[model samples]
Target: MSLLSTVRNPHDLKKLTAEDLPALAAEIRDFLIHAVARTGGHLGPNLGAVELTLAIHRVFDSPHDRILWDTGHQSYVHKILTGRADDFVNLRQRGGLSGYPSQAESPHDIIENSHASTALSYADGLARAYALRGESRSVVAVVGDGALTGGMCWEAMNNIAAADRPVIIIVNDNGRSYAPTIGGLADHLASLRLAPEYEQVLDVVKQVLGRTPLVGPPLYDALHGIKRGIKDVIQPQGMFEDLGLKYVGPVDGHDVHALETALRRARDFGGPVIVHCVTRKGFGYPAAEQDDADCFHAVGVIDPSTGKPTAAGGGTSWTSVFADEIVQIGHERPDVVTLTAAMLQPVGLKKFASTFPDRVFDVGIAEQHAVTSAAGLALGGIKPVVCVYATFLNRAFDQVLMDVALHRLPVTFVLDRAGVTGEDGPSHNGMWDMSFLQLVPGLSLAAPRDATTLRAQLREAVAITDGPSVVRFSKGKINADIPAIDRVGTVDVIYRSPEVTPTREVLLVAVGAMAATCLQVAERVASHGIGITVVDPRWVKPLDPVLVDLARAHSLVVTVEDNGRVGGVGSTLAQLLRDADVDVPLRDFGIPQTFLDQGKRDQVMADIGLSAQELARRIVELAASRAPALTTGEAEEETPAGQR
Candidate 1:
C-alpha cells in the first residue's frame, strides 16, 4: 500500500518516519498531477506546496493550532493532509469539495480566504483573540510571494510585529503569485533565494573540515565561523526583522527537513517570526515548470503526459473579443493606456500590453493602488483603461468613488466576469460589482449582451470624458447577437409583439447577457395571448428617459439581469420608475442576495430560477394576476418577487 493511504489526517501524518516522508511527498505530487489533471483544479500552486504543506502539518498540530493559507488555492495539499484526498474525484463540482478552504468542511479551516493578502490579518486577529482568552494556541499563516504584494498583507504584518504572542509566518516564496512576482519585494526575495543556507549540509561540511586532524585547518576555521558574516553580507536584512519580527530563513521549501527545522525554531521563538521557504512554483512537474505563462497556474482537464487540455473551447469568448477590440483601439489612439492588478493575461490585456509595452502597467495585486494610479494617468491627459475582474474591483470601490468619480476623470474601468462566474465558489463570483458600482455618483455602467455590443459599448465607455465609466461583461463565450429593431434613445428595442394592443401587457428590460433569456421569455409568454416588448438598454446606468415613457405605456414592466437583486441594474430601474410616478406594476429578477454555490454556470443560473422557462411562467402569472385589475378599474398591485 502507498504511504499516503495510511495517512487519513494530520494526526496520521505525525506518525510517519523521517525516511518515509520523501516517499509520501512523492506520492502526493503523483496523486495531485493525476487528480487535478482529471478534474481541472489549481495544479501548479498545489504541486509546489506539497513538501511545504507536509512540513507544516508535521510541525504544527492543526485545528488546535490555526494554520491559514492566504489566497486559499494553495490549500489543496493542506486539504489532502486534513483527510480530503478521497474527495478529489468530485473536486470543484457542485456540492463537492470547494477549491478553497470552507469553514463548514472542517474545523482546520479558519475562513474561506480565497482573496489574496487576507490570511495575515486573520492570523493577527486570531492571535489577539487567543491571547485575551488565555488560550495558548499557535497561529501560522502561509502566504505566497504573490500575496505579499497586496498592501493588506503589509498592514497585518505591522500589527503582528507589535504583538507579544508567538505567530509563525511561512513565506512560501516560489517567486510567483500567477506570474513572476514583480516590484521591489520580488528583487529582495530573489537575492535571498540566491543566498546559501548558512546552517544546512554545506555549512556542516565546513565545520567538519575545521575540526579535521590535518592541514588547512586555519582556512576551514574561517569558513566555519563565517555564518553571521556571510548572512550580513548577502542577506538583505530589515525587510522583516526591522519590523520587530524575527526572521529565520532562506530555507528550501521542498526540503522537508530544513523547513521543519526553520519552522520549529520560529515556533519556539515565542514572538512574531518570518520563515522564508524558497521553492519552485511548479516544482516537480516539468510541464508546469517550463510553462512561462502563469506556470500553468490554473489549468483545465489535461493530458498528464503533455499537460495539454483535453477539451477545447469552441467559440470566441467575451475576453477574446475585448482583447481584439482593445488592441485595435490602442493602435488608433496612442494616448490610450491600460492597467491591471497583476492579471494582464486573464483580464485580456496581454495583447494590448505587448502591442504597446510602454502603455501597459501591471500594479502587482494592488487594486486600490491601480485605481488611484489610473486617476493619476488620467490627470496627465492619458486615457487609462483599468482592466480588472469584476469581483476584484470590489476592493477598490473607495478609490473609484473618490479618486476617479469625484474628480470626473476620463478613466474607463473594464470589468470582465461581470456575472455569475461558477466553479470558483461564492467569493469568486462577479455578482457584486454592479450592485456596489450603483453607488458611484457620476459613474456610467454598460452591460453589453453580445460580442458586437461589447466592442461598441467598450468604445462608448472610453469616450466618456466627463466622469468614470464602466464596461462590464460576463465570463465565457459570446452569444449570437440580438439585433436591435430600433434605437429609442439609449435603449435598443430587440423584440416587440406582432400586434401592438392599446393595453400593453409587458415591457421587458434585458440587462447584459440576460437579453437572450428575456427574448425567450417573451416568446414563451406570447403563447398565452400576452404581449411583451424586450429592449436592451446597453448602458444600464443613467437610464434613458424613454424607459419611463415605455413603462407608462405598458401595464407591467419586467427586468432581468445577471447581477445580484439588491442595488443592481434591476433595482436601480425600479427606483427610477418609482421616482418618476410611473405607477405601472414593475418586477425585477436577478440573483438573490446570497453567496452562490460552485457549479456549471448554466446549472447555477437554472438553480437560481434565472432560466427562460422559469421567468416566462412568473411573467405569465403576473400578467394573469393583473387581469382582475383591468376589469375592477382598481390601480394595479406591484407584485412582490416571491408571490409567484
Candidate 2:
C-alpha cells in the first residue's frame, strides 16, 4: 500500500518515517491527478501544497490546533490527508466535497475563507481567543504570497504583529494568484528567488550554530539581526519582518521533512512567525505545470492525459458575451478601456487584452483598486468597463459609492455570475448584487434577460455619462440567439398576444437567466386556460416605471429571479407598488434567504424552486386562490399612469 493510502489523519501522518513522507507526497500527487480527472477541481494548487500540507499536519495537531486557509483554493491537499480521500471522487458535486475548505465539510478546516488575504485576521482572532481562554492549542494560517498583494493582508499582518501573539503564518509562494501576482509583493518574492544562495548560507549557519548549546541561543539571536541587516542590503525588502513578525524560510516547500522541521522550529518561537516556503505551482502534474493559464486552477472534468475539458459543446458563456461586446465597443470607441481583478480569462477578456493591450488592466486580486481605478480612468477622459465577479464586487462598495457614484463617473461595471453560481457555494453566490447595488445613489443597474438585451444594455451603460452604470448577467450559456438591437433601451415585453384581453392575471417580470424559465412557466399557465404576460425588465434597477405600470394592470403579478427574494427586484417592485397605492397581490418567486449547497446548475436551481415545473405549480396555486372578477362589479380602476 502507498504511504497516502495508510495515512487517514494527522496522527497517521506523524507516525510516518522521514523517507516515507516523500513517497506519501508522491502518492498524494498521483491521487490528485487521478481524482481530479474523474471529478474536476482545483488541480494546480492541490499539487503545489502536498508536502506543505503534510508537513503542517505533522508539526501541528489539527482540530485541537486551528489552521485557517487563505483563499481556501490550496486546501485540496489538506482535504485529502484529513480522511477525505474517498470524497475526492465526487469533488465539487451535489452533496459532495466542496472545491474549497468548508466548515461544514470537515472539523480540521477552521475558517472556510474563500476570499483572498482573509486568513491572517482569522488566525489573529484565534490566537487571541486561545490566549484569552488559556488554551495550549496553536493557531496557524496558510496564506499565499500572491494574497500579499491585497491591501487587507498587509492590514492583517500589521495588526497581528502589533498584538505580538503566538501564531504561525505559512506563506505559500509560487508567484501567482489567478494570473502572476502583481504590485510590490511580487517584486519582493522575485527578489528572494533571485538570491538563491542567501537561503543556503542561512541554512548552513543555522545548522552549525544549532549544534552548540552554550553559544547557540546568543549566536542565533545575533545571527537573526545580522540576517535582517544582510537582507536589507541584499534583499532589503522583507514585508513580514517590516510588519514586526519573525521571519523564517525561503525554504524548499516540496520537501515534507524539511518543511516539518521548519514548522517545529517556528512553533518554539514566542511571537508571530512567517515561514516563507518557495514551491512550484502545478508542481508534479506535467499538464498543470505546462498550463500558463492559472495552472488549470479550477478544472472541469477533463481527460487526465490530454488535460482538455471533458464536458461537451455549448454556446458562448455570458462572460464571453460581455468580453466580445467590450472588444467590439473598444474598437468602435477610442475612449473605452477594460479593468479586471485578476480574472481576465474567466471573465472572457483575453481577446480584448490581445486587441487593446494598452487599454486592458489586470489589477491583481484587488477589487477595491479596480473600482477606484475605473473612477480615476473616468476622470481622465476615459470610459472604463470594469468586469468583475458579482460576489467579488462587494469588496468595492465604498469606491462605487463615494468615489464613482458621488462624482457620477461614466464607469460601466459588468458583473459576471449575477445569480446562483452552482458548486462554488455560498461565498461565491452572486445573489446579493441586486440588493447591495440598490443602496448606491446615481448608480444605475441593469439585468439582461438575453444575449440581445445584454448587448443593448452594454451600449446603453457605456453612453451614460450622467452616473455610474452596472450591467449584470448570469453564468453558463446563452441558449437563444436574440435579435440584434439598433438602439439602447430598457424593459421589453417579449411574449404577448394582443388578441387576448388586455387584463393580465399574472404579469411575469424575469431578470437575467431566469427569463427563459419564466417564459416556460407562463406557457404552462397559458395551456391551463390562465392568461399570463411575460416581460423581461432589462434594467432591474431604476425600478422601471413601465414594469410597475404593467404590474398594476395585472390581478396577480409574480416576479421571478435567481437572486434572493429579500431586497431583490421582486422586493423593490413590491415596495414601489406599496408606495404608489396599487394594491395588487404580487408574488415573488426567488431563491430563499439561505446559503445554498453545491450541485449542477440546473439541479441546484430546481432544488431552490426555480425550475419551470416548480414555478408553474406556484403560479397555478396563486391562480386557484384568485376568484374571477364579476363583469358587473364596479372597479376603482387604479390607473397605472398615476402609479408610475
Best by TM-score: 1
Query: For model 2, how does the per-residue alpha-carbon lDDT over 30-94 read when each residue is reduced to its tens digit?
Result: 88888988877778887898889989998898999888898798998899878999898888889
* Residue range 1-644, candidate 1, lDDT tens digits: 99999999999999998899999999999999998898888888888999999999999999899999987999999999998999989889999999999998988888898889888999999999999999999999999849988999999999999988889999999888788788898888898888665446446765667677664767666864464456667676557877989888888888899889889999988999999998888888999999998887888899999999899775899999999999999999999999998888899988998899999998888999999999999999999999999999999999999999999999999999988899898988898988898899988999999999999999998889999999999888888888999889989999988865546569999999889888889999887788889999998888888999988999888889888877877677777877897778777788877899999888888888888888999788878777545321234254333211
- Provide the lowest-lDDT 10-residue window in model 1: 635-644
Task: Write down the RMSD of all candidates, one decimal each.
Answer: 4.1, 4.7
lDDT of 1: 0.87
Per-candidate Cα lDDT values, in order, are 0.87, 0.81
Error of 2 at 631 (Å): 22
Q: What TM-score does candidate 2 get on C-alpha atoms?
A: 0.93
- Candidate 2 deviant stretches above 4 angstroms: 207-225, 482-489, 497-504, 627-644
* Candidate number achieving the greatest lDDT relative to the actual structure: 1
TM-score of each: 0.94, 0.93
